[model samples]
Target: MAKADMEQFIKSQLLKADLIEIDRQLSVTGINDMTSMLLLKQAFITVSNLVDFEITIRSIYREHEKLSSEYKSSSKNYEFAKYLRNKYIGHIKQELIQKSIEWKPELRYSLKRIDEPGMMFIFNLFILETAINTYVNDDGSHKIFESETDLKYPPDLKRFLIYLSSTVRSAISYLSNLANAFGERVEMLDASEQKIEHWIAAGETRFEFIKK
Candidate 1:
């Protein structure tokens, strides 16, 4: 493979991984800015970002010869990530449920008002837990839903994403070094800064198969 193509494809996946990290951080910040209705709308894309991250890393692992055996794809954290991707993005919840009796699907989230001088709302997730999860305040606070309720949103999501983000950053660095093996440096250092026109202006073309 050519140096430019290797750098481009690998970096592309790394970007997706990095973006998922940024988006999740912003999601916490989002709760402060988002209204109840807006929360519902933004939630899907936020969760979907993890799904995108999964596909990116998997692609780099499978398609790239260098990373194929180097990265192990086995982990509960990784599986949970793919499970969410499958449930929400794939839309095969019923199929999964019907296929296995143990696979029960539930969703939960925590939302509460924080009236500290200025009115504000705090949002958190408690997804995929078997037992009803609760977020309690020492003082009684107004809540839209019961404090202790069967919540489905995975609370561990934020933590899981932290693992993912760090992993991807490592992968990006690892991928960059692969360029040295090709006897070339990553020429397109400012890929994020450039628009599609920049690549077109340069000579990067889409990868096409040449069957033997």
Candidate 2:
């Protein structure tokens, strides 16, 4: 393959590896009242991973102008995600932080408030709203919340997590297909297969295909 194609293929594969890690971390469950703080941390990590995935996808789009239709359709999600990344995750606004504290005075009592389930739920909900536009009711009206209790421990938390996982898996599948397509079109470096086999044999056993 040409040097440019080789570089692109390698980058795509790296991004695929990242998505795999993100998926694994996000798949961890068993979040109950006792583990709420841990769950919040995991959820925060998942959202950060998702933002990184969006950024990587955007980079790929810039590198290769032509992409599949499904990839193109995700542009809107990435656009909103970029906004959320900057506003909430990447560079949180002081105003927002102050508001959060004012809304929950207990937040001022300890640093652990950052990992509180309620706070984390709001952050996750913000990201989800950005990605999907709006949260709504069956009547096509926007969902309204009067207080934290109105959210009721985020009843849709599982659904949001499932959506995030599905999105990552779909992206990985697309990238895998793209890599295979490129492989069929060009001869890889002679040592590539051996390197892959060695890496797999060295105990990356979680990848079922590699073990196969």
Candidate 3:
């Protein structure tokens, strides 16, 4: 590989690495802002974050087999990130999802059982103890609850955001360090004299963005 190309590859990866954090923060905000009025909007934020998160990570490995292998070695989250990207933030494997997609209806007391027996009177009551829109999308990918074991969260989209953030948030610094290290190895070049051809796309390239 050309030194310039390697340099650019690393540089590009570093840029994407920064994006992963931005995506995480934005998704967190969405989760925090979730409400009945903003359900779809908030859900979209999470889904959007996941798609971008996966894309940024995937781009790091593109065209550069050697570096990608090294990059992948640093994080156990790579394959899982790809799986999320493949689903485009909507689809998770239906079978896996189906297995994990069980919700126990909140045990309700008849205003009398609130203190009877071993019933713990949990003072917090969700007024909007409502539905779970856990349906398969057109692409057949499952979402939300297929991830972590916390199914009591209710909202499918919010659940997905929490799960995705959990997986990707921990790796932000790890991937960024890899990119920064590679960037350090790349020789500084005059941008005006830089040849476009000198930069390789690195790995399997995808030009198509995921359809919403």
Candidate 4:
């Protein structure tokens, strides 16, 4: 699929969910708006914030200077800065979980869980899920885990595990919701769509105005 077609698919999916309103000319304006909406929904990343370690490391290493400058409030580089901030913050959280366990041995204590990337990914997944559930209709009680198990809060291993598990689960759940809406299996296919490149090449990326 092309970018336009992919956006069209997204819009159609959202429409199927009765989640958004598109104009009559869905071929043009609707797809554009829908693309923007999905970008906003995913917060401009192809996946959630806790990306795979290899990609994350490469991204940070290659873009560190640009990212660091973005972090500096004085610069007008708002987008890159925000990206760095969010990603680094997520990194910090992961580190904290890891350190918490290390603390156990030195202090002759034990923590609830290990701070692995899968767990970190799950944590981010939870945050996204929380935001989505809140947006879907303001139902906040829809938690990733229904039970108040051992790790129900921070500083506790069981709670952290729940948090991580919930994160991964939520991504899956919301994506499933999206798939049902678009009438197509949208997972991982967004990148394969060629229309996005076509639009960029033609400099017709604006949603409100596309030169037909």
Candidate 5:
């Protein structure tokens, strides 16, 4: 594909879902922000990989063009040969897109506020949110500060922090494996059964052709 064509195609995918107008003060704001950031980060990596793919494709075409010119002869069928080359190029491009999509992640994030609070719950949130910080009573609510507290994070924040940390690690690993699979990436919105059926059909056909 042309550079402009590839860029436009990639841009359309990114623009499909965007984080807009977030309610920052809401209780669920933190989880939303984290999810948005993760999605954006994944998109960024995919775009970078797309660029690498474009460069590789261009190089292949340049080499193909050189060889095509060298083999052209009055007796040799140049038009037929060119058609074969173009078909091969299209197949390669499809494979590249499929691989890139497979590697992407299916991420889900959730947050629930506990109305029935306890001393332990409060401590855990405090610890995770403000690591190594000591809480102080201020206006009947607990507060932790950087300069005053011996620890920055309190125990209350611990569970949240651990959850976020493990989530990030798992997401990265899942994405890496998915990308390495070298197949079309499915979206959360896509019908799972239909997609699987298509893949099975394609795989069978490909296997049959290879055997022949």
Candidate 6:
């Protein structure tokens, strides 16, 4: 293969690797609300992974400084993925920590739990009761709960997880299609490349094969 063909093949392989990563992340399953804390943490991780996938896809277009019409059409999905990442998973928590420190000036921010109102109340009640018992016993290292099933997940959380799973699947499909289209364009360019002899015969060898 010619040097130019080798370059195009490498570019296509790199883009395919990106697509495979996106697919692998999206293929992550078994994220459900078995426990409140576990569910919240998993949800955060899922959104973060989706955001990374979007960034990978964006990098391909940004490298060339041009966006395909298909990618342009799915701009809303990309924006929403970014919003979920920056607002909920990434920046908002940092902002909350900063605000807490500014307001108290001596207290540290700690995320103990995230759950619906009813579920939070139940967990708080359990903790309060357990603390009382442990205080009477004077055991500082006692376990909080014997089993994971001790904490029940809220209905609202279950519904939200379902919605989030659907959203992630939709985003993956949209982004995968865009990546595949990009691969197709790359393949077309590689197929359209002329041999050095042919280019010389046509007096077009002066043109460079610009790899983007």
Top-lDDT candidate index: 2
Task: Give the TM-score of each candidate.
Answer: 0.35, 0.53, 0.36, 0.25, 0.20, 0.35
Residues 1-212 of candidate 5: C-alpha lDDT, one tens digit per residue? 24444443344343222211221222244432335433423333433333334333343334345422322221122222122233222222354333323332111111133334343233332222232221235643433222433122354344433433333333333323323221222232346446576678777774334561
When 2 and 4 are scored with TM-score, the better candidate is 2
Q: What is the C-alpha lDDT of each candidate?
A: 0.40, 0.51, 0.43, 0.34, 0.32, 0.43
For model 6, residues 89-188, the per-residue Cα lDDT tens digits are: 3454455434434443323322343345454444332332222223122454423222221112455334434544554455445545554545554544
lDDT: the better of candidates 2 and 5: 2
Total clashing pairs in model 5: 31
Worst 10 residues of 6 by lDDT: 128-137
Q: Which of the numbered candidates is closest to the native, going by highest TM-score?
A: 2
**Model 2 C-alpha lDDT per residue in residues 82-196, reported as the tens digit of each score:** 5445555566656556555555554466556658756655544433343232333576554432212222246655454554555567667767765665555465547545666
lDDT of 4 by residue, 5-89 (tens): 3454454344333212212122233212334333233332322322321122233324334433322322222232234235433
State which candidate, 1 or 2, has the greater lDDT. 2
lDDT (Cα, tens digit) per residue for candidate 3, span 29-124: 543422322432333343344344445545445444554554445344444444433432344345433332233234433345656643321211
Q: Residue 162 in candidate 1 has what lDDT?
A: 54
Better of 1 and 4 by TM-score: 1
Residue 59 lDDT in model 4? 30
Query: Which candidate would rank higher by lDDT, 3 or 5?
Result: 3
Candidate 2 has its poorest 10 consecutive residues by lDDT at 143-152
Candidate with more favorable, higher TM-score: 3 or 4:
3
Residue 93 in model 6: lDDT: 46
Better of 1 and 6 by lDDT: 6
- In candidate 2 the C-alpha lDDT for residue 133 amounts to 29
lDDT of 2 at 52: 57
- Compose the digit string of candidate 1's lDDT tens values, residues 51-161: 344354554444456544433332333344344445533453554334222333221111233334223222222222211121123664312223433232445434434
